[model samples]
Target: MKPIKNVCVVGLGTLGTQIAIQAAAYGYNVDAYDPKPDAFATMQTKVKAAMQMTRKGPTFPMALWDAHAAKVRLHSSLAAALLTADLVVEVVPEDVESKRKVFAELDRLAPIDALLATNSSSIPISRIESVTTRPEKCLNIHFYQPAVGMNMADIMGGSKTSPETLQAARVFVRSLGCVPLMVQKETLGFCFNSIWRAVKRQSLYMWDGGFVDFRDIDRAWMTFTGMTYGPFFLMDLVGLDIIYAIENIYFESSQDPRDAPPASLKQKIARGELGVKAGIGFYKYPDPECTREGFLLGA
Candidate 1:
């Protein structure tokens, strides 16, 4: 429960990198690790770019970059990163087996007293804890996308997760200026994803029913909800592959037809038309000079 000084973020993907950056910004010594050399290199470059921008005044992307570059140490080796870490956060992929493998290795590498956490959105904390010896310290610390900006976080406890462990996680999340919602019972998808699944089901139903097109559905939702973007638009930004993966998880775990993604989504995934990152999805981004309309089909 004491203040976490040295933090290790295992998995330097999009979410892990963001979490490490946030921890560094809060003055915590952060060591970010990933197996891939290229990923580590990318994070190091990104952190340096962010720091340079921070030194400069607010200038569009530079301001944004500086905001991200505050406190991060990039590492390629798990052993090296965890040697000095008081807390270890596993932000690997959502697959249960993959998470178990990471947790097992972390258990072997990290200090005995080091608090271990997972950034998994849907996988149950109990399942993850079952793989590690330190079940009392293993828990879920789900951060929303743009973890640095999202103030809301979900802290889920397995059956063996100690109360002190939960308290420590709450304190750590608060230190980062984020609100931690304590979940006593760990469930698949937890709170956010459970709500999101419902919303996704309803949206897909409407789309499949021929009641609306993608654009109309997006416009209606944005106009009524005051959100920056509609569900489809957000999905596009999140990548169609990820959306498919999450939906597949939900469907497999719950056996709920509602959680099943539509055929159109399946087709998109099959075609490798992943969203913004890949330049095409429900919409497209032909080039930097292209207009939004140009990204739409038959515009």
Candidate 2:
């Protein structure tokens, strides 16, 4: 209802931290919360890395990075973070019950008029809105990782979500200089996510089915698309564990065997091969071959 001057970001993981930084970079007062105190310690370092990476993409007002970074306020408690927030963005794990629990808590703790949103990749907002009394103000404001490079987000509403809420969300997304892809009705994976999901599914199948070597597939894809990363490299960036979880969600919803995550991914998880964070996944991190310059040109 009120101008969204203050934003509360719950969860300080990869995407969560970036959202908070991006909001702050745009001069919004950001209150970031995470249950783990240790996460708070790394905020500065992570923010620096994200800024460095985003600079490689689009041209922006680079001077604002420092001024905006100063606007972020960290807290360990949800109530403290939501105290002055006009909107709250939840970026927790993609588990249904976990999201419901966070939504319930947010509804109870945040200001009555503060709109609640989730950054979930696949789970629809309606499934989360049922746990709160303010369903009309709850929606999905899904953001792509490395929020700076992909300056677009999926904005979807639950069945009971109000039109006013949706417009307010659009306004909020625009405030961060990000485009909002509106979904008129509830949908899994929103827009780009649905397309990406298909690519991820096919990529996993190709690797697991022994149809082609992963590196060759990536090489051919880069040569064709002239992109920096292929499906496997993107998977590594998105995190293998997260990919597995997203696949499981699709499988559970459709009960289609084809949607089930590949057994190889599960094995990777068992061995703690998360992704760049663990320094190993589809490719070694910090210096993944696909990320090298001239990769698409056969470097």
How many residue pairs clash in all the candidates, one count each? 1, 0
* Top-scoring candidate (TM-score): 2
Off by over 4 Å in 2: 40-67, 297-299
lDDT of 2 by residue, 157-179 (tens): 99899999999999988878888
- Please give, for residues 1-299, the per-residue lDDT of candidate 1 as tens digits: 55679999999766677677677767789887888867744654543432332222221243444455545776767899899878899988778889999999999999888989998877777877877889999888887654323456789889899999989898998887777887867677776767776777778778777888776677677568865456776666556777777778778877878777788888888898886556687666433112234322324
- Of the candidates shown, which would achieve the greatest lDDT relative to the real structure? 2
Estimate the TM-score for candidate 2.
0.92
Candidates in order, TM-scores: namely 0.84, 0.92
Model 2 pairs in collision: none
